[model samples]
Target chain A: MTQTLGITVDNISVTYSNSRLALYNASCYVQPGSITALVGPNGGGKSTLFKSIMGFLEPNQGQVDISGLPIHKAQKKQLVAYVPQADEVDWNFPVSVWDVVMMGRYGYMNLFRIPSSKDRRLVKESLTRVDMMDFKDRQIGELSGGQKKRAFLARALAQEAKIMLLDEPFTGVDVKTEKAIIDLLLQLKDSGHTILISTHDLASISTFCDRVILLNQTILASGKTEAVFTEENLAMTFGGIPTIRNEERGTRNKEEKISTIGFD
Target chain B: MILDWITEPLQYGFMVKALWVSAFVGIVCAVLSCYITLKGWSLMGDAVSHAVVPGVVVAYALGIPFAVGAFLFGFGATVAIGYVKENTRLKEDAVIGVVFTGFFAFGLVLSTKIPSNIDLFHILFGNVLGISQEDIIQTLIAGFITLLVILLRRKDLLLFCFDPNHAKAIGLNTKFMYYTLLLVLALTIVTALQTAGIILVVAMLVTPGATAYLLSDRFERMLAISVGTSLLSSILGVYSSYYLDAPTGACIVVLLTLLFIAAMIFAPKYGLLRRSHSTIESN
Candidate 1:
């Protein structure tokens, strides 16, 4: 197998143009070929970290790299793919699902962005993988919330990038769609793709994610899911965990051999 | 009578020139309008279009190329808007509204103060009927370049407009895309100013695209439909202006507005008529 490309964020800090400090000396390493959940509350700098890793927002303090390469260089090599939050998209855009999925192959396409035969095949395969082939020609805005997330997931899949960053993929999706997405991420992990997903859905973390990063403008904890997803870390990240523990009581799995993180 | 309605305007030299210039300008404006409209930058288009008036007045005073002055000032207005939006708590629409009106008022003041035979009425409303050969050349060049750039960079620009974060993550220079879009918008306004003037140019840039948006579900189709609406309106507006003895710019804008209203009501899937029909049937 080719050398696995993992994400490394080193002491990065981000401050928005509005003088709001979004991240402060934050650092973490996503192991190659693993699923890492960045669990944080709303406005906890998860999106900021994703943007920093994607080279969209330059850090005020430090650097981010993918597989020991500078972020921009990694991006040019098509080493990363990102699925932005639904709120970041203009749903009323005129592009069809096929058009949006086809954008994933743009890095491989030439200046005019005419798709090659391979590009076309990959787009079709990725859409079919996400079960969105039936809606390929439909306008993107016509899809359900879950379907829109799947369409964007299909876009990320089509990029064939080594590292995938998804921001709040579970926010608006149904339970079944969420399971399907998690299963897909597992398949990607097994294939040596490094994946980082930021979400507030704590219940699913222990089931499939190999690692968890508890964050609230800074890293509260970072390690294997069982070791780092403790109640104390959760409380620190969420500013008190009474509601989380109450919800966790109802959904604790029957097989308690492995420590499970749940707060639904 | 139909044949004369078509051929009568073709006989005049100025009419033929106006037709060619407006056709070229219409296509450019229509194409760029799709990006402007979809990106929710209609107010940005308004800001830039109005901001060019001062540049044109100054260009006339300095005997420089109108495009240069117009682009500089139009681009300056966008910069000013960006600066204010970044620094202030005010929203984007408010910033755009403030800056454009300020630039336009400055131009109005300057035009009144400047000692020249420049027709303030023509600057405000356009003089397509009295267009010069030099203006035709300038319009064609600006329109051609704008069209070519958009054609080549269509996908990147589309991605940037639709989801800039995704565009950035995929290694596209989104900052470049942003600036390039603004630059093209300024150029499009310059091409449109000669045909539609300061006040009506924003309408020319908005109506065709919005009409096509109502009529089509896909981007490529949207482009084709907008270009069709614009080309037809330009030809018909110029021809009807000859017979009706009206200002050509107002005639073009009126026709485009009428077409937009028609599309809003009568478009196949998204039209108000179809929506109402579907509601009635469901009941």
Candidate 2:
């Protein structure tokens, strides 16, 4: 069951030390027990926003709170889980799928403490939920792109995090994998888990996402998917929508070039 | 016959000490090298090892323990590289190259200024056979401490090396992990000083883990393989040195290099002759 809590981001702004302004007075509240899709064009500050919420990159102004608690306080209680951009990770790291999943439990235990049976059971269950139980013994590097994404989801699932943030989870995933992930997110949301996913797959956004936050160097609009994901907003989000409205069809795989910059 | 072959090297006390010091050096280096290779910090290892030369030489002149000097320079080099990398527009590799070279040059110049009795060559090229009891004790203690820390924080370090973003997301101190590794690297270099010396210690820190990486996809297997290769190379290096009448450190490094070549040809996935994948991850 999910005990998802709302995330409150005040008028936070982030400017890197190099004077690069990544986010400008971005503010939004992620409603509890709902799935929110963070949609943005390339270099539109989606990942930066995610990092800010995860307490990875601090905001120069304002603060982020989880259910009225500071981000670090919530994180110390293991209240948040994050799945980074798949490309940001080194897949060739010498770890088994099982080992990777076990890393989720690192937050629950103290340093040098071995994983207990409870942790082991959770890892197995999480892998089974992601349809990666059979691949538990396999190396993470040996997995296909879809399998790799599933493994990451499994790791996040094992965190038992009330608030989950996924960045570009469906970038290179297969249709089957994407469908499975959407189903999982829906199911998690139903259980009251707060899920934030950064993605470009607009087709799925209309289907599963309860809320959509359109970002372009800032939060463009955030509300019900149908309410916020209109033609005007899409145009503004991706610089006139490129004569298209996000064409990530059933054709899945990284090699299948997405209709990028708003349309193919 | 097997007994005699094994017992022959056990005859001399110097050989015994050589083998003993190399064993500790091999295992510790192998263990720490896994993290080093995973994080792509081979150059850091090189930088720290070379930077410690002046520290060791200075410690000798100042009547301090060489480890204090080595550790200071090693840690200093790490901070300098980090500072240069952050403060300037230069890339990490460029910063590493510039900072490490400067420290090494400083070390070389300082070596000339020190009394010749300090024997800087021994620091550059190890004299494992001439290792005093004190050196042996220091290597063992330092290796033990460093290896202990690595083992204790294995998963945290592993996660940090693989995905620092996720590590920080999970509330683990990413900076602490980064510097802890540097701390371990410095300790390992000092432990390896009497056996591999400054120049060869980098080889010990990189070759073992890289070889193991070629052999396995799982981290546990990689650890076993790395430790096995390192210990095997140590024994063979010392044994061959006795027979070939060559230097122990050179022989160990040569043996390690030969093993790496063998792995390059025979490694199931990444080997030159056996490359099965079109584009493999370069560990």
Question: Can you write out model 1's per-residue Cα lDDT over B139-191, one digit (the tens) per residue?
Answer: 77778889889989988898888888777777878889999899999999888
lDDT of 2 by residue, A1-264 (tens): 233488988898998877889999899999998999999898889989988898888798988988678887787777888887877878888888998889888888878848999999999999999989999998887889889999989988998988899999998899998999999998998888999999988878999999999888888899999999998999888977754523543344555555342454
- The runs of at least 3 residues in candidate 1 whose Cα sits more than 4 Å from the true structure, single-residue gaps closed, are A1-4, A242-264, B87-90, B279-283
**What overall lDDT goes with each candidate model?**
0.89, 0.88
Model 1 agreement with the true structure over A175-217: per-residue lDDT tens digits: 9999999999999999889999998788888999999988899
Instruction: Name the regions of candidate 2 deviating beyond 4 angstroms.
Output: A1-4, A16-20, A244-264, B1-9, B276-283
For model 1, the docking class works out as medium
Clashing pairs in 1: none
Interface RMSD of each: 1.6, 1.6
